[model samples]
Target: MKSLKLMALATLFSTGLHAQDRVKGFVYHDVNNNGRRDGKETGISKVAVSNGVQVTLTDEKGWYELPVGKDNGIFVIKPRGYKVPLNRDNLPKFYYLHKPQGSPATLEFKGVKPTGPLPESVDFALLPQQETDDYTALIFGDPQPYTARELEFFEKGIIREVAGIKGVAFGLSLGDLVGNDLNLHQPYIKAVKKIGLPWYNLIGNHDMNFDVKTDSLSDETYEANFGPANYAFNYGKVHYIILDDVLYPNPRSGKGYLGGFRKDQLDFVENDLKFVDKDKLVVLAFHIPLEHRNGDTFRSEDRQRLFDLLKDFPNTLSLSAHMHTQSQIFYGTAEGWRQEQPHHEYNAGTTSGDWYSGQLNEQGVPAATMRDGTPKGYAFIHFKGSQYVIDYKVAGKDKSYQIEVFHPKVVGHGKNTRAGIYANFFMGHQTNLVECRIDDGKWQKMTPVSAADPAYLAELHPWDTSEELLAGRRPTNATDSPHLWRTAIATDLPIGTHSIEVRAKDRYGRIHTQKSTYRIEKAKEL
Candidate 1:
């Protein structure tokens, strides 16, 4: 009888511990913006809340309960027609970090301080806002500033142009907000706040705490500054899923990091999407591109699992940025896309192109052209209902300047030469049609070629051949440009300067045109 009583007591203790692991929260409206559930304030019904993996919706009373682990973040997904409050740095405050033991002391950077016990009620407050299906969002890829000086360049070269601008809803940086230095996170936040918009951020490989051994602990510093590394929010008619897809300490090699998602993140996505309307547009934002030229950079199984989870959604787009170069990739049935229309992934250009390398410009900033011949720039995504159109805005230039043409200033008249006219359409794709004409001559189709951009080569040549060292660091070596078009120049033209016009039809059926001049000099007597 004594042993039976001891066994029953032990079982009772284990059950009580399990009950303590669950947490409850309320999603309420803060009418006075004081961030408290006042007596008059009412709870919002049907609000979705998550505990990193599992998702649950609030009842009619705006109360929700979910099981929480030792290290997890509880967040409320901001639904449409409502807005989350922003902190002093303009970062959305929608998550509560729960770390019972805090971060390990071996970490190089600081992480979240320990929270002794779960709160009696962990509530989230949201304010009302007017949102519509038609809206615009500013997207920036990799504004990675390694040092204080480079951060200055970012502030002057990128932020100064769009500060306090009108007509945009909000903005987000893909990742690598600061280069390896965790200390620069504050400076980057201060600089980006100048834009006067609520900003969201992703945790890149560089943003991790490399001193940690496991991937789960790598984002300690990032989480300390930003909110949950994986979370979702609704804007207008679009559902944005921000993810930290970088797997640190490489699961395979146990040394470096790789591009992939963890099992818990995938579970969260799968559970979160269950409540989303199928007609809504789904946008996934992360740091590294799913498709890499160097071969199999992302884990194949993880991608397949993600695809399976997203198969039912017909309209979906993904954005990534670690490459610095810009390109549009399509994943068809061969790549496990289940929909008829292939999935589109935009590998956006970096604000810090080629790691802020190249010669100094008139503005005292590095030209910083990308290796794929794309200029350092940002993208504006305009969404109408379920459709979105992205426009790339090159810094220090007018918005209309979309194409860069390169050709010899003068060519021999009536003498066949190997010189070719090359046009680098910044947003061109393989399926897009590009044509060129000279002096109102017949329009000829330009062949798309995977080759180096001659214009970028011209920028890089001076650094190599100059007797004295250039002012700024040398640009990275050229790579094959995916959006470049070329056609042989006709040397049989008249002996005068001729105007050449190049027109490109983008994937969205929008036409962009640019013009240049080339002179045909009469061949001298031999």
Candidate 2:
């Protein structure tokens, strides 16, 4: 009889714990100098309450429920306008930041330093949601500044417009805060902080401090000041994922300047995917693009593994930077796996707007995209719950960007006969396409040539205004470097003269076109 009673008592205790499996918290807007949510203070209604994933509006009384893991469910999303208090590391004190911070010497992820009174009631104050016909997260590609003057170029060009975002909820940078100088992050962050919205930062190839040992280069301070380095947050209806694409301690260079991810972060991504609804959109963002440099640069082994994890999900948007121009393409069947197009990618342009090139606009901004004739801008994405649309918004320019086009330079009638077709878009990134058309026929795509190829890399314009480089961001030493642009040779050619025109288009429907005329005289008898 005693043993039975003990067993029964244990069962009841287990059930009780299960009953409280979730962490319970109440949200209140900070109103009238009071931290508590009072009765009808004209606040809290329509306020969004999220456990960091599924979001629900607060009831008339600011009542909300957050489902958290039995053990780690202490975090609540900090409402906009009112920010959570910062801890010693400047991290928000509330909203469940898992780890704790002991000392600056310690790693940043011991989890957040717990919370204050009102354990169950975590209130948030919002500045009233700003509604627009659309919303966007402007992505800047590699704004790799070789010097402080280049930083000025960044500010004078791209920063001016980004600093003045009107209806933007937030902006996300795809890494490369500096050109191999980790020291620049502080000033870079300060400059970008002027944007006024909650901007998320990512680590890039150039941002690494090579002097530090690989283990110590974990970017602890980055997470300390910028929150979780590998974290997912909900904004509007979309789930934004900012990943550390550049794995440090790279083997190729014996340094951390290249690309790839650590297994730990990849695993984190796997776990994060489980938190959201497959039907909803998943935006995968990183610095190195999946398809770059003649389709070689990407986090494939890991990316494919991740691609498999996300393939089952209904909709996904993958965004990247690193390459300093604009290029975009689709991938996968949106269902089963195809070996060919496993994933889609959109490489963003530099926010320094052509590395601060060209003359200044009226707003005191420089001509960032002066070379390709493209304007400095970030992407504009709009989401209605789950469904969404992406557009290109060139900063300072009144018009939204659409894809431009050029016809392939083909010598003959068949495949592989393509002579040459190069795209010269500057600071152009986003969901766009560099499609081509032959003799005004069906539009075809011109594959992005490599900036690594001696011929092409030489032509690729660097935004950094180094005095040594000549026209088009290339070095004036090209004539002697042996890497200067090489003459292109097309294998197949017909016996007649031909003319071709090509066109380019982005998701925003922006367009650019190019045409060339060539003659192929009858070949002499061999």
Candidate 3:
């Protein structure tokens, strides 16, 4: 238990000292809720532990040994039916930082200080908790607040609606927890904790320490706030892996950052999966999308390596949020995926939509609708066994308000309409079945178009073309909305109010129906 001299593991390895070669650990049941193993406390068997890359399971006596080849982290993966201790920020403290020499000294944000020496017996304690296969997790993306005022706007605009929400097992924010201002980390945590659930966070590109010269030290502040930037945990039948995939000081550009993973991260995935069941749903959550419109933002080799690691796992899904837009991207054989079933990556919609722009609504919060016409909202991923379905919830709106139907409110009597009816199914994909019907008539298939959402354009127009200054900033110009569907309707129907109903079946086979009323009137009345 004595502290060894402060020395990097690499230096010691070169000098032929193998003090840090192996990590011996015990996974014990914390009967009294204490974090230490007592005389009567029993060790838990078959528990998985890891040294970042290599994974090992506890023996019958709850003992495990993982080889720590270099300066690597050692942590326990919380098994199902067991709960790890949580820190003050409600973050699960299931891992211990193993940087003997600590982080590099020059980084602006401080990382873990020198821990001196490896412990004789590194132990993990867990309390028992009952979990259900059918549970929902609250998912938020890019709650990136820049200032205290913007933080307040985030609280009032998004968090206000889901405060103290029930029926959710836990919550996850898909990175970009704060804007460039790292000081807002605590404030962001304070606001999100109001939901009263265990929360996990992914380190975003904006969350990195830009002052750091290399990508390895980029996450010092993030790691200081949240535990390990990359770690894994289990709940019910699912194994959730949270990774820090942002590589700062872009290797190609030598500035800013790139979206990808390090070799150790891929190795961690390979090692961790060794102990996981093939049938269990493996979920990976991170910040940058694997593929961006500008092309593949992440390195192709890293993605291929990840896909290779996930080849055996039949049920897997990755969640990302950086584009500030909501869309579903599937990677198949063309993307180097080995399995016949393509990997599904959900590029989540941001809570801070369009950098929190647009005019303020009656609630005094910015409209902040994303450029794609998707509202500033969060999502709920419902999981049952190894299968899952996602539902996006627009802040301050009812759950049933899933589709935004755009059409003219009125049309001239007996005249053919030039404008077509557009439906922006916020959680839709091209493969989804989108159809529209008029006044109980037969449904007509809607065409998928890669065009801007007219509704979002209309939302931005009032501010863009304003004669006077508006209360809030103008929203960004509309971009191609991937989820938009359109179908033309004839205004030749008799003069009266008509209902246009839109029906969509998502990839998961969940059907959603929404209707809007449009009127036909005489020319004189118009």
Candidate 4:
């Protein structure tokens, strides 16, 4: 009888410990705009809440319970037609960090402070908004500024242009927010806040704690600024999943980092998707591109795991940034994708183009054009229902400027000139159709070829051939651009000025037209 009583007591103790580990919360409509859930306020049902892994919905009374650890962030997955509260800086305050012991003291940057104990109730307040299916999101990739001067360049060159810009629902930066300094995170936030939209950030390899011994502790500084590195939410018909795929102290070398996900992160994605509808469009945003020209930068197993989790969802898109250059990468059956439609990963162009390199423009800002000949630009992702389209916007230029047309200044009439016309469509893909027209003539098809951009070559030549010292830094050597197209133009026309127009039908079926001038002059007498 004594031994049986001891066993029962032990079981009760274990059960009590489990009960303490669970967190209960309420999702209520803050009608008055105050955070508290007043007695007059009603509860919002079916709202999703998560502890960075498992997701649960609120009950009829807006009550929810989820398991959490000592170091966990309890956040609400902001539902469509409802918005979360924003802090003074317009940063969304949707999460509550529960770190009893707080971050490790050895880190150079500050992290979250210790919360003595769990609150009696962790409640999330949300306000209602009329959301339309068709909306635009400003997407920026790698505004990575290494120094204060570069940060100023970002503020003047990029932020100043988009200040007070309207119509964008929100903005997302695809990692590499700053170069190695974690202290600049706040400054970066202060600068980007002028855009007047809730900005979401992704953790990159550069934005990590290098002193940590394990991969899981790599994002202490990031987590301190931004609640959780891995989280998801819904807006309109799209579900957005932001992940921290940078694995520090790479298992192979134990020195540098690797691009991959941890098992817990994979589990979190799998668990989160269980609550999502398969028909909804799933957009995964991360830092490092899954594959490069050489090969896959991330681990195969981790990618396969994510693929397995996403197999049921037919409509999916991934966004990444790490490579200084930009291109479109498709992964089909050969790459272990199970769906008939290949997975499209858009490697977005950087805002801090080529790390703020190249000669200064009239505005005294670095030209900073990317090595691929694509201008430093940001992308606008327009979504309607489950469908989406991307539009690349060149900074300090008109919206209609999509392609750069490069050709010889003058060609001899009735003489076979070796010069050819090239078009560098900013967001062109293999499926895009590029055509050129000269002097109001019929459109002729331009062949897509992997070659160095003639325009970028011209930009680089002046720096190398200049006798005197240049005013600003010189751009890096050009690489073969995937979106470049070439076609030999006929010089056998009448001697006069001719207008050459280049039109491109992009993968989304949208047509873009650009025009340039070329002179057809008579042959020079030798």
Candidate 5:
């Protein structure tokens, strides 16, 4: 056969151009123009295809090459929108192992036993998405931790729960793979690889370092850690687009820290989907929530055009993190999303539930429950043909029913306020304020709210009982740990400008100050 490049050039021109021979193959959108890989049929074009060190874009035919090595290699780069299957260890589906007959080998995964036999082909299939079927996609907000110990709070439990539990075609985590410290990316990647399923990443607000200067500061560090931060892969009959939606406007001096996709990547998405079936479903995953950040005043202007573009797809389920709590939302011309209800619109839950804060359960697991009733856990999704279905399995105890929290809007600014003291808004509004005294002013004892409200247990799951859903908040302990939000009181100092100092004692014996501002507005204003 003539070289792929010669063939490509011959088919289109009079001059001969050599094919960049590495491994010539392609990934295409299986547009259901009915059972055939036709010439005129479109392919997933211009997506990134890499061979570990080098990266390139697939030509118009969705065809690509990266100097294939018969040994120690296979095809893999972010497949654009689709998700990749992670092994029980959580490593990606794209990797090559070159072992010389019975030589002691160093494994990429710490515990991945010798895979034994390598497969003949490592190809991924992408379905042209027209619309989603009877399915939904589960979304996680964030699981940012400043330290390694925190990753344990995630792996010891939630990581264990997700193994082989493959009902959904794929899964995703909102950004903040590590805190601002980029070094954690490797360990975090190695840790989550345990689930052993196809997964993708979303860029988030917390995923960047505000210290760097320039938009091009290159998340190359992030890229090396998580494989081209913005790439794609395929899963159960759908074209899932995983984007490095976070643009670090400046890393050196710190400038464009706002979260959104770049013009080039967005252009790639539009071009990549050229072969996608317009009527099929589209699964978009990134770190920053596409919706307004918790309380932003206007819709992101950048997303408006993207949203308009998304309308072309019959069904689209966009998942994001950043809020560090569980939230759900729907866009498009859908009725449920168009209407305003806390339940139908918001961010997804975080992986750590609350930065791995609070006391351990009877099982010695960190109590990771979101204020919205969901606890620290990963979402499960089932994708068949062109549809997706989502279900959340919270970490901690094995739950068969959805949790439900009943409480009125928080009242009064004092930690003693009824709702403020008992409400587990650790996932919504962080209300950890200190209560101080004026005399020789001894900071007295107070009721500190636990991120995982031990008492915040849902009296009943959403199925057994009903309640309004609210937006999610992130896990605290960003710098350290939020410890425990002990006990407190109002000090009853005639509602006006008053101040107080607060402290909390944790189950781990760690103590922290709850010193922050508090306004004693009329309770009726709640």
Candidate 6:
């Protein structure tokens, strides 16, 4: 009888039906926030938990069971009104990584160390917090500090200004936290900790283990630092899904990485959304922009699959930050969007702006102006119930400074010169109205043009033209600015200093104005 029982147990284990094949855990309310469940602490029912791909809910007793793979991260989908404990760096401690075999030993930067065996029960604790429908979140793109010096630059240039900033719920970095050097991850964390918010991060192409052979292992180091490459959380009425869309060792050319999603990730997304209410606004964030560049920078089939999965959700938004330039891309029927209203993807500007290039400023930080003329800055997304409006805050500048007007310092009087006045509306879309007038004159509509920002060109010109080497690295060449507006300057104005006012009405029905002065001079005899 004992031999027969052993054989049956072996068969069940092989088929993944035995009790040993599954892991049990409890999602409980930690009344004391001690990071563990005690006798008095009780489990929370109906909370969603996942083992990477499959999602399961806790029972009435708050106990849950999930089939575990050899390597998987079991995490609780952070629900609204509940807060997770944070580490010293303010990174949320929500998930438990179960890698019994651990990461490969050959990896250069090091990954998760070997975790010998699974515990009898893994418990996660949550604390309650008050969250309102109207709140603000700080969003940063590509604080890609390549060296320790550059990291300090980020600290003084960006973080120093917003440190201890109030009225913000949390902060998120869209990725490339460090350049290609994974060793700098800890320093980057230390630098950002000054902001004093529960910081969240996404894995960018630069934050990968390039030495790995397969894409599955590319995020070993990243996972060690930031828990999971893909996870979901909730704040008020918004459901945010953060993903690792970078596919290293491009499957086609076997070279650099590309932007796409794996089958398992898509499956996780599909399963995760089942628990989300259709009325809630879903926000997806990743490192690379889904919008194509050059020839299909991102995989089309994968994008279509994602779109199909999101077809049921009426309210959705996606955020990306790879190009270093800021632009708004809309996906309509042509891009396989299933809804009547097109989807919007905001390719945000980077905080590291042009890789920390250009001459040093008064603060001894790099000018780091973006290639599109959008200043190096961060964004504040104000959320109310499911809607949001984004405002860009330029570093070391007042919030009211939104438009950069480019015009000659002086122009010949009554000359029909081609000297045009250009306004680089950092947050303006092509559909937004941009008007310009001279000294309280009639407001004339400025035509939108897909051309380079002359202001950025002027900044770039000195490096090449200067006889001696400049103080800092040269900024990259300017690309055609998508949010630029142009109008001919009325040189016929009275011959004195005249204030040129440019007002831009943004997509959210907010108007921003900036003024520049130029003198109309009399013609000099040649």
- Across 340-379, the per-residue lDDT of candidate 3 in tens digits comes to 9999999999999888898787668888999999999899
Report the C-alpha lDDT of model 5 over 1-526, residue by residue, as the tens digit: 5699676555222211122234555655545533335555566776665443335677886877654332223344444344334445454645443222222233221212233443433333354332434444445457676677777766776677665654444457767777766666767777766666555565455555444443332443443344445555544456666776666663223455556655545654665566566766677777766665532422365565566556556666777666655544545443223323221233566777756654566646566555444566766656666555455556654544332222223235433554433222222222334333422267654443434543344422332344654222223422211223434434354565444444433222333332333445554542
Candidates' lDDT values, in order?
0.90, 0.53, 0.86, 0.87, 0.50, 0.90
In candidate 5, which residue ranges exceed 4 Å CA deviation?
A: 1-90, 93-140, 166-169, 209-211, 250-256, 293-299, 332-346, 371-373, 405-526
Off by over 4 Å in 3: 1-21, 69-71, 292-296, 524-526
Model 2 collision count: 38
RMSD score of candidate 2 (Å): 9.6
What would the per-residue lDDT of candidate 2 be over residues 51-153, giving only the tens digit for each residue?
4333455677666665432222233344333444433322333444322222134432322243332255545443334443245665666667767777776
lDDT of 3 at 442: 97
lDDT of 4 by residue, 383-436 (tens): 998889988888889989999999999988888867899999989986689999
Report lDDT (Cα) of residue 245, candidate 4: 89
Better of 3 and 6 by TM-score: 6
Which ten contiguous residues of candidate 4 have the minimum total lDDT?
A: 11-20
Candidate 1 lDDT: 0.90
TM-scores of all predicted structures? 0.96, 0.59, 0.93, 0.93, 0.55, 0.96
Q: Model 6, stretches more than 4 Å misplaced? A: 1-20
Q: Residue 523's C-alpha lDDT in candidate 3?
A: 62
In Å, residue 432's CA in model 3 sits off its true spot by 1.5
Residue 298 in model 3: lDDT: 81
Q: In angstroms, how far off is 280's CA in candidate 6?
A: 0.6
